[model samples]
Target: MTTSLGATATAASSASAEPGPSTPAPADELGVRAARIRSAELEEQIRTDPRRFRVSTGDRPTGRLHLGHYFGTLHNRVRLQDLGTELFVVIADYQVLTDRDVADDLPGHVEELVLDHLAAGVDPARSTIFTHSAIPALNQLLLPFLSLVSVSELGRNPTVKDEIAHSRQAAVSGLMFTYPAHQAADILFCKANLVPVGQDQLPHLELTRVIARRLNHRYGSGGVPVLPEPEALLSAAPLLLGTDGTKMSKSRGNAIALAASADETARLIRGAKTDSERHISYEPATRPEVSGLVLLTALCLGRDPRQVADDIGGAGAAALKAAATEAVNEYLAPLRARRAMYARDRGHVRQVLREGNERASAIAETTLNEVRAAMKTLY
Candidate 1:
C-alpha cells in the first residue's frame, strides 16, 4: 500500500536525470554538502533558540501508528514542541486519495492519530494539529504553487515513482503524480522553516525547498522572501525492521501498534522471526532478524545495542523475546495509559481537531492572501 509516511527519495536533482526503480539518481555532492551544513546550522539554532523555528510535520491517517512512528518522528516532535518551537502537525487526509481508491475508516483513523499524538506528549495547546481537508485555503495554495513547478519535475519526483511502484495502481491519478507539489503546499502554507525528515526523504523536501525559492525569486516585493525555505531536521533514530524482517507496517501485521495491550505486545514478539542459533548476538550484517530484536530492546531501554546484545549473549531466542517484550511493554505503558484515557472521551478529541482546523485555516488564509498579493492576482 502507498503511504505518505514511508516513501523514500534521494537528494539528487530529478530535474536532470530520472532515477530508476530502486536506483537513486547520480549523487549530487555539492547539494549533499550544502544540506549537511544547513542541517547542522539548524540543529545549533534549535538548541540555542528553538523558538526561532517553525516546524511542519505530520502523517497520513493510514492506520494505527507502530514503534516505527514512535522512535522515528513522534518522539522528536514532542521534544521540539517542548523546546518552544511553533509546530503544525497536519493530518494529510486528502493525500490518502492520491493512491487509494477509498479511505476506509478515515474519521476513525484520524481520531486514532490524534490520540496517538496526545498520548505521545504532543500538546495541542502548543502545536496546531489539523487536517488537510478541513483547511480549504491551504489546499488552494496548490494551484499557484503548481504553476511554479513543471509537470516534468512532478513526474520525476522519486517519491511519486516509489509510491506507484509499491502501490501498483492500475492508473495513477493527477493527485498521485503531483503528491510532491501538494506536500510543498502543505509546508509553505504554514511558512514553516524547519521540517523533520529522514535522509531518504531529502529529495522530497528538496522539491519543496525549490518551490519556496522559485516563489520568492519570482514574486518577492523587496528583498524579503514570500515563503521561508525550510531545512531538514534529520532524526538520529535507527530504522526498526518488522517482526517478519521487512519494513514495519500495519498491513503487514508485523507491527506492534502503539495502542496494543501488554499481552498483545508480548504475543507479537513471541511470534517474531529469529534464527535457530542457541545463542543471541547483535550481528546485524549476518543476523539481521536477531539483531533487529536486539535493537528494539536497546531503543526501549535506552542502552547501546551492542551492550544489550552482550547482556543477552548465550540467551536463546526465547530469552531475547522475553527481554524485548518486557522492555517494550514497560516503555509504552505510560503512553498507552494516556491513549486509553483520551480514547474514552471522543467528544474532547473532536474538539481538539475543530479548534486546530480553525487555527490552521486562519493561518492558511493569511498566507494565501500574501501569495495572491505577491502574484498581483488580487484586485
Candidate 2:
C-alpha cells in the first residue's frame, strides 16, 4: 500500500477507537485532545463488552444516499447490527429544512431513506429506524440541551461552519445554527454509548459529549448521570472524491447515487477527469482526478488503491476507467436491485417506519421522563 493509503487506514482505525470513560463535568472539563485519548481507551474496553454500548447515527433526508454514505458509515452499521448491538438510525427529516424550504419533496425523501436503509443492509429487526419528527420527546429534550452550549461554540463547530459556507447564506436560520443541539437530543435520548461517524464529524460529537456532561451534572439525581456521553466509532472507508476531483455533489453532476443504473455508473466513469498519460497509478495529490477513479474502484472492491492501480498498470486511462466502472457497477448492482425491490413495496416500508416511530416514541418518553424527574418537574 502507498503511504497515503496506509495513513488513511490507520486514521480510520483510530477514529473508531475514540471517546474515553470519564464523565466530563462541564463544557471546559476536558480538552478535545485529552477527551479523545480517554475515548480511545474506553472504546477498547467497550469492544470486549459490546453489550454495554448503544450505537446511534443519522442522516438528513434531503436526497438519495450515495457511495459516500454507504462506505463512510452504512457498511459498519450493518456489521454492528449483526453483532446484536443496540443501534438507532435516525431519519433526520427536520434537519433538511436547514437549507431547504420546499416541503413538497420531504415525504418522498423520507420514503427514500427507508428504502436506502433496507438496501444498505440495515435490518429493521435489529436496528430501530425512525424519522426525527416522529418523536415529540426527542424535540423536547433538545430544549434543555441547547442551554448547555453557547452560540459562539455552535458557530465554531467545523461541520456547521462548512455548511454555512457551502450554503452561501448571508443569514443563517436559528434551526440551522442549533441543529447540533438537536442532534445531541437524538443521541442522548437513546443514551447511545457509541456513534459511527466520519472523522470530519468528531468536533460535533465532542460537542454532544459536552452537552451530556453538562446536563447530567446540573440535573442528575444527586449527581448521578442521566445521559451517556457517546463515543465515535469511525469507519475505515477512505473518502471518495467526486468526479469533478473537488467534492462529490449532486449539483456538480459528479456524484453517483447509490441507486444509479449500471449504465449511468459506466457513463460517469468514462467521463471522469483523468490525466492525459497512459500509465495508471495511485497519486491523489499529484493526480487526484485520475486517482479519484482508482480510489472509487479500490474502495468498492475493498482493495488497496496502489494494488488496484498496479492491477490496472499501464492499461491507459480508458482501460483504467473501464476497470473502475466494472468494479463500481458490480458492487452496486445488487444494492440497486434490492433498493428497487424495496421501493416497489412502499406500503411495507411505511409499516417498517411506523413501527420504528412507535418504538422511538416509547424509548424517548422514558428518557425524557427521567430528565424531568431529575429536574423535579416530572409532574
TM-score per prediction, in order, is: 0.91, 0.88
lDDT (10s digit) by residue, model 2, range 243-361: 77877766677888898998888888888888788899887767888878887887777677778888888879988888888888998988998999998889999999999999999
User: How large is the C-alpha RMSD of every model relative to the true structure?
Assistant: 6.3, 5.4
Best by lDDT: 1
Clashes by residue pair, model 1 = none
Q: In model 1, which regions exceed 4 Å deviation?
A: 1-34, 98-102
Q: Provide the overall lDDT of each model, using Cα atoms, as 2-decimal numbers.
A: 0.85, 0.81
Clashes of 2: 5
Candidate 1 to truth, TM: 0.91
Q: Which residue pairs clash within candidate 2?
A: 16-234, 18-39, 19-39, 20-38, 20-39
Candidate 2: where are CA atoms >4 Å away?
A: 1-47, 168-170
- Angstrom error at residue 86, model 1: 0.8
